[model samples]
Target: MYIFSGDFAFLEIWYVSSSIPNMLVNILSESKTITFSGCFLQFYFFFSLGTTECFFLSVMAYDRYLAICRPLHYPSIMTAKFCMILFCVCCVSGFLCYPVPIVLISQLPFCGPNIIDQIVCDPGTLLALACVPAPSTELICYTFNSMTIFGLFLSILGSYTLVLRAVLRVPSGTGRTKAFSTCTSHLMVVSLFYGSLMVMFVSPTSRNPAEMQKIVTLVYSAVPLLLNLFIYGLRNKDMKDALKKVLRL
Candidate 1:
């Protein structure tokens, strides 16, 4: 989730940066002469996809919780209808949340400063290009980032809060053990996602793009997803059992 979240955030920023002309574009009368690189457009498309994948993972987690904790109700709770509805919500929300920011960022004229101090296009870079005057585009970024962060935090908190309650109440010792395994996996995922988010954002300002690149690459590309695969895949007993069954051992 952290990987996808940051990737989507970066892509939306890049889409604007790549499409719009530099701050020079706004000052110059021939701004319309500017064009974006085709390669950047392709990358934008690639990065934007992370949003969809993140949402789908959330939906899948919800399904898993329903299956385990509410076995009898799982069929009804995770009905095909419910799954479709959740999928649509994820898809629509991703598109709606992303494109408007791209529009706002594109409006920021990148005339005077062409050097983007990051691995990829980011809100910081586009806002820097506000043509000597600080671009109000950063305002748009704050509103969007805050809104998305708060909303996701609330939903994630709510899901895990209920999950904790479910895990604690299992009757049998073995059942409790299994429940704890599931709870621990979910907690690990949540920690990896939110911890990386805070590390990247709630920090002293970077001196250069190199610092930002290192952060963005580690938190968004590698660590969190690796944690996900570890906690949810390798640690899953059913998966282990299935592997054993398949090997006839």
Candidate 2:
């Protein structure tokens, strides 16, 4: 759990950092303009980080399942070496999935009115700005996003489902309660993330209103990142005790 938490903490930092600084600048600047290269760079990093986050969340769920459901074998199965491999796999897979769609979108011709209705470089918004229709491009982007979002989400559900079964089998109510408590924080974070993520990216052609898109994007991209500190950190007994000590000091 600590290994996964360390990876998650690093991911959350980069995930939020990728776009928030630029977003803050956009808020303060008069022109509210970003260069073509800048926009795509932001888009790539932001989405890549997001994709990485999905994998991390899924892995964390699997880790919890192993710990709870297969406690006897967990130490052997989830060694430091195995954890490092999982970390590498998540990062590589996350960064690799988006390049094809991003490249496809970047190749599209944008003649004029180069304004994007989104706060960030969203694929749907970028596609909308293209000079000609790009139904194929749109389909490709939608397929990639859907596969990543839904695939990882289902994996999480599967892990938790198994974990739930194991918890139910615990004969003692206290044991069941303890097992449920271990998973509750992770489940909350997953809910906060995937709820808005699915709405926004599952079917990009839904063409939600610009304001609506911004709101949803903020919910998934920024809100969960902020809430995770509370969900994972403050919710931990050690962290809470440390906080109380600091407060008293």
Candidate 3:
């Protein structure tokens, strides 16, 4: 769990850092302008880190499932070497998946009026600015987004489903309660992250009002990350005790 938490912490930091600084500048600046390369680069890093996050969440779910459902074999199966391998796989897969669509969209002609209505360089918004219609490109982007968002979401659900079954089988109520508490924080984070993402990305249309998009993007990208430490860290007994000690001092 600590290994997974360390990876998650790093992911969230980069994930938030990728766009928040630029967003703060946009808020303060008069022109509210970003160069073409800057926009795409932001789009690339934002989505790539977001994709990596989805993978890490699923990996964490799997770790919990193994720990809870297969405790006897977990130490052997999830060895240090195996954890490193999983980390590499998640990072590499997440970074590799989105380049094709980004490249395809970058090649589209943007003759004039290249204004993106949203604060972030969303693929949908960028596609709308193309001088020529890009139905094929739109379809490709939608397909990729849908596969990543839904595919990993279902995997999380599957892992938790098995976990739920195992928890139910524990004869003692205290045991069941402890097991549920262990998973509750992770489930909260997952719900916040995936719920906002599905609303923003998995839909068939990009017709949401600009304000609505911004709010949803903030919810997924910023809100969950801001609350992660509280959800995961503050809930720990050791962390709570430490906080109380600091307060008393």
RMSD of each: 8.5, 1.5, 1.4
> Model 2: clashing residue pairs?
none
Which scores greater on TM-score, model 1 or model 3?
3
Per residue, candidate 3 scores C-alpha lDDT tens digits across 2-60 of 78887888989998898899989989989888999999999998999999999989999
Question: Which whole-number lDDT from 0 to 100 does residue 201 have in model 1?
Answer: 39
lDDT of each: 0.55, 0.90, 0.90
Query: If ranked by lDDT, best first, what sequence of candidates would result?
Result: 3, 2, 1
Q: Over the stretch 1-249, how does candidate 1's per-residue lDDT look in tens digits?
A: 233333334433543343233433534765332233432343344235444544554664565567566879976676666666776787666655567667666665567646554444555554655575443556666656565654665676676667668877877889867766655765666566655544553342243356755575356544555555556566657878887898896
In terms of lDDT, the best-performing candidate is 3
RMSD of 3: 1.4
Candidates' TM-scores? 0.67, 0.95, 0.95
Q: What residue runs in model 3 are displaced by over 4 Å at the alpha carbon?
A: 245-249
Off by over 4 Å in 2: 245-249
Stretches off by above 4 angstroms in model 1 are 1-47, 201-213, 236-249
lDDT minimum window of 10 residues, candidate 2:
201-210
